[model samples]
Target: MRKDWQNLAPAHGLNALVENGTIENLEVKDHVANILETNGVDLNDVEGVIWSHWHFDHTGDPSTFPSSTKLIVGPGFSEVFTPGYPADKNGHCLESDFAGRELQEIDFSGSDVTIGRFKAFDYFRDGSFYILDAPGHTIGHINALARTNASPNPGFIHLGGDSVHHAAEIRPSEYLPLPESIEPSPVPKLHSNACPGHIFAPVLKDGSKTEHILEWQDPWAEFVEPKFGLIYNEKDLRETVRKDEELDANRDIFTFIAHDWSLKGVVDEFPKSLNGWKNKGWKETTRWLYLRDFQAAVV
Candidate 1:
């Protein structure tokens, strides 16, 4: 229904999962600093940089930010990634990123607040933002739940950092089942505006029937294997995804993963706030857009 193919591309073209790539090829035209500057935001005003985990891709060129900007990380981050790069020799991060800045690690052991089975830390005290301990992808991996509004019917945006790579990992659950028919097919070049959901049945995991998109016992049935085998704890990651599915099912919450290609053109970009997502109908539009990735298999 929405004709915005300008941002639509094959899943591979939009995928951020890189393996054994050179820095030159991986370089992007705009970094966080560039985006902030474009929006008339000064780097000096940024008080803190929160890292979901110490992964190379997630930790952008932090050295660009002003030293006054504190670098916040999850628990066990210091124990492992501290004394970065040259000093540690085998560290994943560079010392320059933390040289003159204060690197603060989040310790959730004392926090009693819990949100959707996760140990939460109210970053702003005012329920507006919360940092959740979501481990599995790596040690001290965390996710964020941001309250978009304060009204009686408030909406939340769950920033799922590497909790799951694709929407298929957490979608089509008991709470959000696949529709019998999908309108405005995700395949960009398709002439038909609607796609039958049964086409994807052939690609479902073994023993999974078309009756349900994904079963509780096997949620990742339609997901692809990770390009890089960097999962720190597969078992814990499964549990984290299970909890994520619950949050995704909540009508008021929008679960957005770091690498979700479905949201490319659907959600508003930075400079445009995602505050009124519910009113804008962002969830309904983008929820099933990931189905486009299966175009090759289904066709």
Candidate 2:
């Protein structure tokens, strides 16, 4: 049987992705650990751990799993973490750290790994679920896609890993509150190239003898971060919406930024049985509710 699914990394650790500058929240880690414990699945038994990227939020609990488990990383997992473009102190881990664990390095030959012209990660052999590689939010950033059998058309549950932030950032009609300190002017043309977000970037022109480097707009810029609202400045959520619309056109692609408040119900409703969860009941301290009614909605 297929390994059961769990909210490995659920709950908004980062405060409000919209107004708060917190990129990731520690609380999310607590939630992830709690979810695992609630399901009665020992962290030591986790056979594999897939890290979409080296972002702190995603890699918060790298040490939690057993050293014997396999760890899967994206194309430049090692490069991005150590002596890479923009080195992050908390974002990556060295090979030596794993010791005896297996490491699966997926280097899509520099091509996007998703289905349909982009980086897509499929689970099992069914293609019902997938992970989309969408950098720019980070060097190796990716998004999760879940196609529920409930609908004839694709019913995608996009777990956006900072690729596209809150829905307000994508909603064209939403009025965003922009800080006056931050200008409304276009991001410098050269800035985008200097930054690593562009999937295609920094072109070299002229002859090899005297190479002249020129930068061009990335066609996939929309997928990175689009101009839809004030908060969407970092990512082109518009592109994400467009791509999501194209592939899962029925409009069932549910977009959930890591920190969205609405996720409380979704995470709570996540099948405990699938993850081997044994604990139940609401908590008065966190005001957390494990409503049977909500759990019944999973099917």
Candidate 3:
């Protein structure tokens, strides 16, 4: 995305949804820039930036940094979306986005390693970070898993970009089962220690109902608006659901999706290290909170 401070609307809002609906007064900032400034890091200090997918939200503004900043993307990105925008006449990428930069397209096929349910590629080759093939939300979608703490027993911080949007998609799975209890979070503006899990079932068009994982009393079953319109292919979506269930089951992995509204203000912001997520009990506090969105389903 070009940093056109002049017409800031396009940079922030999803123009594709304008006809159906959109929100005004929404301004998307260059988060990469925000992180750099907050940490007192220079632009040139950034070695590279990898995108989980080619979506507008994930791509952000690579042009804002120096021409030297390497732009890394998942496989098939160039073939699927090269000669961007005006050049391709039908592409979603902007030519200026990759102009004069060292573009690296990573291929995860034929990899020998598998972490959890994902085929993993060790980024640093030192066991610190990895790029996992995470398809579903889009073509060539990927995710990152970083070993944040590694003393007695290692813990991971998973950057789950667009893999799953809601707790419903990631909850009650075999790997990460619902916790028995949770501590209250200050951000939700609540002062408390204990909150229980909320699980619900969905009614079918035939008027029959399917049971939830544990049949815990639930006021909300997952009902994402179909109008929001996703572009996930069959194979990708299937793999996504399969692997997400695995990731959700694992206790050591802290997976953060691209647009998890439940995470906002609940977790630490940038410039604050999330390295201690395990010690702080972030997963416990935020896990069942998405059930709050089910309020509409409750009578």
TM of each candidate vs. truth: 0.82, 0.50, 0.79
Query: For candidate 2, which ten residues in a row score worst on lDDT?
Result: 283-292
Q: Point out where model 3 deviates above 4 Å.
A: 1-13, 178-229
Kindly list the per-residue Cα lDDT of model 2 for residues 255-299, writing each as its tens digit: 555644534643456434212111221111111111111222221
Candidate 3 residue lDDT tens string, 5-47: 3232332235634434554554555556665767898988887
Better of 1 and 2 by TM-score: 1
Candidate 1 collision pairs: none
**Model 2 spans > 4 angstroms off:** 1-34, 42-45, 82-97, 110-117, 150-154, 173-249, 265-299
lDDT of 2 at 24: 39
Q: Highest TM-score, which number?
A: 1
Ranking by TM-score: 1, 3, 2
Candidate 1 error regions (>4 Å): 1-24, 187-191, 207-229
Query: Candidate 1: global Cα-lDDT?
Result: 0.74
Rate residue 116 of model 1 by lDDT: 91
As a whole number from 0 to 100, the lDDT of residue 80 in candidate 1 is 71
lDDT of 1 by residue, 1-299 (tens): 00221121223222233332322344456567767888999999998988997655576667778999999898887887667766776555667668899998888998898889988999988898899988878778999999997778889999999888888888677666667777767765663777776677765655243222332233333464332234666787888888888889898999889989889888998899999899999988888788888788777
Q: Is candidate 2 or candidate 3 better by lDDT?
A: 3
Best by lDDT: 1
